[model samples]
Target: MTRDRVPHILILGGGYVGMYTALGLQKKLRRGQARITVVDPRSYMTYQPFLPEASAGALEPRHVVVPLRRVLRKCDVITGRITSIAHGDKAVTIEPEAGEPYQLEYDILVVALGSIPRTLPIPGLADNGIGFKQVEEAIALRNHVLDRLDIAASTTDEDVRRRALTFVFVGGGFAGAEALGELENMAQYARRYYPQIGAKDMRWVLVDAADRILPEVGDEMGVYTVEELSKRGIEIRLKTFLESCVDGHVVLSKGKPFDADTIVWTAGVKANPVLADSDLPIDDRGRVSCAATMRVAGLDDAWAAGDNAAVPDLTDDDPDALCAPNAQHAVRQAKLLAKNIAATLNGGQPKEYRHKYVGSVASLGLYKGVAHVYGVKVKGFPAWFMHRTYHMSKMPTFNRKARVLVDWTMALLFRREVVTLGRMRMPREEFRRAATPKRSQRDGSN
Candidate 1:
């Protein structure tokens, strides 16, 4: 039971809430009073809302992610996945690459391990579908889409070309809709270089189980978004689910089977599965249960927030109402949680987390978008402008902000980069083939 000289705070996950919460703690606490450590699988925090634009060549991939090491200089950053949380012992088990499981004790723990892609047991999903959650996934998807176009342009087989040109996106939320829109826009522009392939030749389908898309925005704006996307020849399939996607052959609940080389899954997200392994109190959805103050119920010096924690929504009267898992709530919750943690450590009363839902904005390709900001509805170019402006203001650090702005500026003057390096996804495949021994000595031996 030997204790470290300085009190340690272990923050899990380097997402929107985790990074900001650690930053707040470092800035508030004295240099020597407390030590902070952040553990996440990624070495950087991705500003996820900018992912669509980044995938479409509107923003640099690097600019959309903030390096955890460079940003959190005051805190210890561990690049590893948190396997389990031992709340009773105030410790966490981390599994880093090429290492034995190690436990790290903390006086305070912030469970900010964010949500993962909510996947279903639908046939062929695991084999054929790719998620749009991480930076690597985004980059891979961009390259894959462009590479598909290249394949289609060079191939003479109609079936192969059709499959390559056809792109299917499941989930019509912000992630699915925006990604489909931006990539479609980029692919359309790319078709100009290929004399054979035109925008009409490419098929883009967006499928969602919900009746309405972009539920974050109001119904009016959602309708406007659907209209704009439909006008661009992008098919929107509502109240539909992907029944199966076996070997790229997709069968929807309401449509005929179609083969697509690119299938992106962005339907929704659920809390991290790690929560279920811990002794901490969790809700029915496998999210850690926490009060409005962001403290895990019946736990001492432990708090949870972000997508993984089901924080009670004080603003809503429904007993079952919980904060929606979004960046808006995560950012606000992080600030409050940081202050609360700091206060608890310094013998002060912690504050409760509360914030009004402002609104949402979604970019629908180049100059099209839909937004509902503070009950004021905006559509078309105005909404698009607002989407960019809002995200630019929220993007982490001045460096990333400047880099993203520069990316946009260059995009305006130059053609979007359409080149794709699909081989990057499996860079070692060639080596694997080359290393394999071939049968050669049969002439003399046989």
Candidate 2:
């Protein structure tokens, strides 16, 4: 592609980094200063922090995601997957939802394609384990869990009831812990509707390979989290791994084998594999290697950030330290990236990225949480409030922020939405069944 006075900026992913970068650039750059284009498989950006609560029905799923076309109105929005990036030619191949693969040329490149769930080669995990990284997955897991409760309440067999009531989550990080906590709280509230299933009948388990969970929240809060979850009757299995889960029979490395219908996997994440196909400087972990200024190493006109880029952590003593792949860093990096891009366009030098690691916050259940921020430790109701307030503030747009706040307010006034819409998964099933003829009618005995 030939360069004009105004360059065509192509952003690869519509996630935290991609969305925020485009948003900032739209506000900073004037009309025709730069033509920004963002591409991703989804039409909206999911605010991942609220996923656990969304799954638990604390927030509406639609409110947690920001529509790309709506928010980035000034920028061109492309809904598709990045098949490959040929930086040598300044071109990218994209396969859209319904069309054949096509190519686009750009003068400036922005790579923000985020990470995927780090899954293992476990036998049954691929078939049974549900991922927790997407909004669709969150809703599916919610329906599946509630359906399991329905099965438990209606079943006559004890084994089936026990299997349906047992829910196992393999990972004790923020995703797993928060999901387990919020879901357990939701399930407990749902138990009031089921006369057959008591609070003691259900089993909730969290398994992690490491000796501790919520490592980012520090030792004291981590200990407190363990104790608090234990009080909720949720078993915390530390230093243990899943040996096998073939056919829904979960066999832990240190526990008795049991059958469970629901298995949620949230271990960790690795950089997007598509980076490997790109002609970019990448690290051993398949992440784009970048300088402290968020520019791709040794390359101009190419930039990377978020979970897919290995940006140096200047605040840490370790020279090789990379900023943790979380929204806290990703959002900040995207903002800086926009400014740097603008500066470079105006013949100004780019600044290096530097930020100290801040503490983390996690919600255990309704009105229960833990946090370690700015060297201060807090837990219980205050921690829960902080967790909500902090994330709400970070949530993009006043539209979503107001919706989530209203959801929380309505929750306090009434009750949390616990009813599951299982039909969403099989919208066509009912019509198909209705259209089918009965055996007697088919046999000419109508």
Candidate 3:
């Protein structure tokens, strides 16, 4: 398509798909062959699996993120949200963080915009609920959890103390389960320093509409996770959902009611709403429809992957099945998508992306986990080791891997940092107040 100037490759959403796809292209394509431009709201890609550890203070929050521009030296990274795409004209409307919307022309388009948190219409949810998808939310939850401990230890009102100590999480997938486990583990350690509060003073509850937790690892492992969490005095509510969280009073579908200061929402995710405005083929669930080769169905120049794409699963014998949205598939799909794109660009035949499902591993806490690989099942320390080793190997870049290892090593040599920096959230409060004259001073001076 390039008669004179170089081809422009516009990649949407600098997440797992965008970042890895760009890396693959940089390695495969020749200089000036394709000018890659990545558009995302954030400048970095977050390693979501490590979010639980970051929230628990097991790893520094900054260590779990990869700077997009720093890694993709050959590509132009634009921190913005993609408004719409006109694939017919090979153009897109990009809304930058601090500028007017502009049209971006591209010969090749990669829609990796990814998914957003799927929220239900529940009372008071907007006022009290927090999500677990991003690094900021994880850090806020960490500080909020510790600050709750501080509140419980200092308060004399029984109701206030009880409310502050109660932590409620609504979901039982990898995100919810691991988050509850890690934070509970950290809270147990932090409780040691509080003379007024004991381990029994805190209440951790996990609720899910599904019958089992960690469904990716199969039934046996899921049951084992429930049992292990039960032994830690964590309450698991299956076949239930949150009805309301009005004014911090949570009401369950089972008719249980309780006052809670903390509410973490990790129910699930849906494709980014921006896709609804595009001309691409989207399925009923709002995911981009892609062929086995990861190219957008019926579109020669467009491709999609990750949580936002419904790619037919060739690995599954069932003809009706589509690839489950997860990091394992997303990472692998990014590579193949890039390869297929490159193949088409070079006038070569594109290959289909197919791989059997690799098994799942999840960390429960510092020295606890559950894993199922191939046909083998492991729990306790062995599973924990597998969890750490697998993620450490999968985490992008040698620099991040080294930093994560150092963080673990330091944790082993010393106690975990249990302090909360809640003040960081409102850093300008003191300054703002100091700048304002006192009421008495204002009157006397006048």
Candidate 4:
């Protein structure tokens, strides 16, 4: 804690809140006042909004993620997973590759290890379902979807073709809806190149437990979204839940059973599992319970925010309300949290964090979208344009913004890329086959 040595601030996770908070701290704090250290499994922070476009081949996967080291030059970044937070000892245990588990002591800790995909006890989900959270998953899903199309077109077996063409998405939120819409659009355009495959032949189903989708937007916009998707032949099963997906057989609570080759699970997210290992008080949903000021309840120096923090919604009149886990609140909370932290460190009273829900926008494939922003409802091309404009404006750096814009511009001037490189997922499979001893070669009897 010596002033000359610089006070250490350890931030767990390099997601939206973690990266932005560290960036804010580095810019605001004096050079020797504190040292900001960020620990995350990945070296980059993904711009998740553009993931659907990236998966659809409209945007390159590399352009969707921002490297942490490149952006956070002022702060020390650690590429490792935090195993445990020993708050009593003022230290955290991290397990990194090629090194023993080491402890890093800190004067202050920021718990921002964002949420993970909330998977249910549903069968086959762990084995077969793909998540749309990270950049690698998005790239894998894109390749897998395109590969399935290739398999369907080349095969004459009806059952194999049916399974290959069937795609099931279990969630109606932005991630599920946007990903399915974009990929379906890509597949539709891609089918033109395959003589055996057609848009009509593909089956796309979106299942949601809630009766409505895109609850961020009002009910009216949500209804409009459902109607529009319905017109596109995307099956919408409202008030239905996925009972199980054992062995590729998907069963719904509504009594339908079908086999689908591709199942993307974007139902929702829960707090990071590491939180449970810490001494921090968590809510019933396993999120760190925090005051509106972004301070952990009853903990003097600890703070939490973003998807993993259950911050009370002061803007709402309802007593039971908590802020929705979205980028809007997360970005705002990060700024306020940083200010509050700085204020506390400087002996000033921290301010409360309060903000009203602005609005919501969703992209539905290329040149199509739906939005309800500031009481105005927009759909189709205009909404799509607004969606792009809004996310581009909010995207972290100018370099990333420019790169994304360039990707979109290139998409406008050329046809979408539909090439599938499925072997990338398991490149050794081909090598394994090549290395196998064949019967003709083993006996030299051919």
- Model 1 agreement with the true structure over 336-361: per-residue lDDT tens digits: 88888888878998888878789999
Q: Locate the minimum summed-lDDT window of 10 residues in model 2.
A: 1-10
lDDT of 4: 0.90
Candidate 1 clashing pairs, residues 3+ apart or interchain: none
* TM-score result, candidate 2: 0.97
lDDT for each residue of candidate 3 in 192-275, tens digit (9 for 90 to 100)? 899999768899999999999999888999999999999999999999989999899999998569999999999999999989
TM-score of each: 0.96, 0.97, 0.97, 0.96
**Which residue ranges in model 1 land beyond 4 Å of their true spot?**
1-3, 428-446
Off by over 4 Å in 3: 1-4, 441-445
TM-score of 3: 0.97
Q: How well does candidate 1 score on lDDT at residue 11?
A: 94
* Every candidate's lDDT: 0.91, 0.93, 0.93, 0.90
Judged by lDDT against the true structure, how good is candidate 1? 0.91
